[model samples]
Target: MIKPGSRWKSRVCTAEAVLIRPPKSEGLPQCGGVDMAPVGEEAAPADMQPGLDQGCVVGKRYRSEATGIELLCTKAGQGSLGFAGAALDPVEAKKLPSSD
Candidate 1:
């Protein structure tokens, strides 16, 4: 139930859905393919702009290509949280006991 003008929320749902989907073509090409560049990158074509915009949740989780690290955009709750960090703060990362 998104409002008509709530394009941002719509985009967030779309992006989350895509991330949850199985790779279409298979192999590395499907999952994070060479052409499937990170959001806000020049390598990402204009056609993908709409999808990326819709997918990206401001002040939320985003894939950082440079460091290969997934960093939080802002404090939790303000933005849609990723699967692991749904309601958690980055400080909680260290609190979780390792399975090792």
Candidate 2:
């Protein structure tokens, strides 16, 4: 089970992430359409490749509503944040209105 402040790295790509929000329960965190391993863990052979073409970008945050899990991109790679079979969309920063 992943918890808040937990760090993980992409097994398939060069992407790395850290969990900001923990999931409600034990849920599998995936990136680039493959499961992610804990930081410092050996990379899985099955996840040693990019699953999606779009790929994840550096400095982007990804989250899931169903599980309430949030991840921040550390290193960029050809892997998009995903859970189960669905891809997680990048979190957009809200812009503040001008005080003019």
Candidate 3:
């Protein structure tokens, strides 16, 4: 019987036994065999082109035009609060300058 820590040794022995045996010739359906195109002969363009503006920015602030608040993306923090839960009256928002 194999010990708990000797499990790896048993697995290696089993693998060695399988490797020493001659491979059986059972005809299997082989899909397109090794007739691949030469490297760079018919290679498709990169899935994504580099240097193209893919909506990724290193440092920038994304703000909402409808709100007067601006978000500083350079700092580690949440964006300016939107019109969520505020005790300010509706007349106060109207009194403020238009964000647009």
Candidate 4:
């Protein structure tokens, strides 16, 4: 299982992310249609798919509802995040409570 706080980097682009929540099941997170490797590990050069290069925004949280996996993009890049062949959805920011 990929534990929370584990960092990942894209193999095909400069995308970098930190795991916020682990997936309920088993599977690695994919970026640019390729599996992301852990930080510090050398990544083999790969090609980014045409549509999968939508890009990941820095400081945004992406989540996969089906897998219960969530990741925070620490560094923006030319690749989108996904899992199990499905794109991960951006998490909406929670509204702060109103102060009287």
Query: What is the lDDT for 100 in model 3?
Result: 85
Give the TM-score comparing model 3 with the true structure, all chains together: 0.18
User: What lDDT tens digits, residue by residue, belong to model 2 across residues 4-68?
Assistant: 78888886678888888876767667776778889887776455334454677778888888868
Instruction: List the candidate numbers ranked by TM-score, top first.
Output: 4, 2, 1, 3
Model 2 RMSD in Å is 3.1
| lDDT per residue as tens, model 4, 1-100 | 8999999999989999999999998888889988999999988978887788888999899998888999999989898898777779999988989889
Window of ten residues with lowest summed lDDT in model 3 = 9-18
Candidates in order, TM-scores: namely 0.19, 0.80, 0.18, 0.91
| Clash count of each predicted structure | 1, 1, 0, 0
lDDT of 4 at 45: 72
The lDDT per prediction is 0.26, 0.76, 0.19, 0.89
Which runs of model 1 end up more than 4 angstroms from their true locations?
A: 1-45, 49-54, 63-67, 71-100
List candidate 2 segments past 4 Å from native: 47-51, 96-100
- Candidate 1 lDDT (Cα, 0 to 1): 0.26
When summed lDDT is taken over every stretch of 10 residues in candidate 2, the lowest stretch is: 45-54
Instruction: In model 2, state the lDDT of residue 77.
Output: 78
Overall local distance difference test of candidate 2: 0.76
Index of the highest-lDDT prediction: 4
TM-score of 1: 0.19
Report the lDDT tens digits of candidate 1 across residue range 1-100: 1121111111122232123222222221111111232333334322322212222333443442322323333222122322221221221334567798
User: How well does candidate 4 match the true structure in TM-score terms?
Assistant: 0.91
Model 1: colliding residue pairs: 11-54
Give the poorly placed runs of model 4, Cα more than 4 Å off.
97-100
